[model samples]
Target: MAASVIELSDVSVVRDGNTILDSLSWQVADDQRWVILGPNGAGKTTLLQVASASIHPSHGSAEVLGSKLGAVDVFELRPRIGFASTAMARRIPRDETVLNSVMTAAYSVTGRWNEEYENLDVRRAQRVLAEWKLSALEDRKFGDLSDGEQKRVQIARAVMTDPELLLLDEPAASLDLGAREELLQLLSGYASAPSAPAIVMVTHHVEEIPAGFTHALLLADGAITAQGPVDEVITAENLGETFGLNLSVTRENGRFAARAA
Candidate 1:
């Protein structure tokens, strides 16, 4: 059996006297690619934080990469997990070059300082850039890139460390049709690779799900509506209930689309 990359048991998070997550339990295996669907404020980001070992659950136990959250030093555990999100992106210096932006991830820093890097690190960063199709833009400033290009850079940076678990928050949000499709294509190819790490991505739209994702988890009101194989969990009935509206869902060629019915 594949080992569990993430395990949450009756986990709940409360902030400022309000419940952000309520009794959520989930397990992700090392071989699975998962997509999390939810409306705004459904605690999707909070869930990812728990998985990334950035935040401990307010209640119950949480485990990531085989270490219990409260028992482990997150500073040490964090390097083993790759995380990309809008919040993380804002920390990068606008003047940082694309190659530096990715190489800095080796030290888990947002920007390059006086950190010493070896020849092997530069080669690894260059290889990752090529894999994400950003080799040509390696010398370009991160702030000068297009939205699609910036998004790819973020993912490339996340994987630069060769983490065991990867967490992405709304990676395809705000992209145009062409940009979204291009990003999805790259994500699909990465997720399909045999050596790829366990992945979990959060998105508001099912249409943004990539082709090779194997599992789905739908969230509403800080609770899980459904979860399992992608084919079974992303149905019209499940989506309708999750979004509080009648939705028509379709799946063809391993991609998903949803609309109001």
Candidate 2:
């Protein structure tokens, strides 16, 4: 319901004298899809944790969907945001049916319980599975699917509730070239849809960024190196600064490619 889907002003996260995020200020409007790009230890995932309300910032303010992080009941706020990550994937039962893996999101629980689910929930899961091309795998155990298929299922499960904001952490990680392209195509199509939820995906590789993502935030050493429209923030100089290397970057047909120059 808020015009600003996510806003972080002077946000900092510290633990045991280590600062994971350093005085970060960022905002995401309702219409934007953002890619988080940074090298390892750049605090990309830390930033997502703050935005998704999994943790409060040590200082400054965070607001998502009109709810301020520290002031709101996170349990109530959690379901309004959809998050998918490797840590979350580990929580799902390996033998869980693909259909129930998604259907369980409606109740905010990890596994299907003895409580009866509504017919509409099942229908919604079916539709989401179809959207991710997981309809055929609905009867299969989650563990039986390949890495790429499991990632798609996770994305589908995250969107099952139609969250106002969707957060994906390395949705394309560890995939073969073909699988990576497949997931990227699906994400690009989802992002291009005007009706899709505002999205933020964290990835270590520039090539993993989907075509329709509109904005980017580049972080390095726990601070922002660049943040703006995708084309501007992804230039060679900016990327070089972000990654501590001399780099050459190119974009064509809404996709990006980069290498050390």
Candidate 3:
């Protein structure tokens, strides 16, 4: 097995007298792509915050890419971790070109200012756009794109810096069926690439679990219900327990689907 890219031990996060994450322990390794599934308020996003070095645990320790969260300089560590979420996308300038949006990630900034970028940076951004099938939309405005297009562009931006770990929150949450499938296919292809970064995506629907994901983590109310291989951890019973309803999980053509029983 590859080295652990993320390790959390007895981690907990408290805010406003409420425990957002409760003594959670999890590990992610290189070459493994994970899907985090749970109901609302399950601390799924909180887990990603810890993994991305955006927050320190209220208790226990977290080591991401070999650097302890509280002991290391997080600003230095954050650049190596790529995170893309709807909140992050909301910060992007509406009129910014897609190319610049992706390129700005190289500088760890959101909006482009008077900063000068070298030709190499431009070419790399172009390549990332092409890799995400957005070469034709490079000149388009970020706000001009559809929800699905915007999601793809955000992912392209997240990975433009070639991060060691990628964290995505609901990358397929709002898309229609065709758009969702298209993004899923693209994600499946990206996950299969040998050089792609380790990925952890948070999604509510099992149907959103892209192919090539190796592991699953089921969370309910900030505690883990199951954690292991996707097949073994995401059983119907586990899903039912996590969601507070009886569920039937079925797989077809290498994808997962869940329904309330």
TM-score of each: 0.99, 0.98, 0.99
Q: What is the per-residue lDDT of model 1 for residues 1-261, given as tens digits with 9 covering 90 to 100?
A: 799999999999999999999999999999999999999999999999999998899999999999999999999999999999988888989899999999999999999999999999999999999999999999999999998889999999999999999999999988899999999999999999999999999999999999999999999989999999999999999999989999899988988989999
Summarize candidate 3's per-residue lDDT along 75-184 as a digit string, tens digits: 99999998999999999999999999999998988889989999999999999999889999999999999999999999999999999999999999999999999999
Across 1-261, the per-residue lDDT of candidate 2 in tens digits comes to 538989999999998999999999999998899999999999999999998999999999999888999899999999999999998888889999999999999988778879689899999999999999999999999989999999999999999999999999999999999999999999999999988989999998889999989999999988999999998899999999888899999888888999889
Off by over 4 Å in 3: none
lDDT of 2: 0.93
Ranked by lDDT, top first: 1, 3, 2
By lDDT, the better pick of 1 and 3 is 1
Q: Candidate 3: which pairs clash? A: none
Q: Say which prediction, candidate 1 or candidate 2, comes out ahead on TM-score.
A: 1
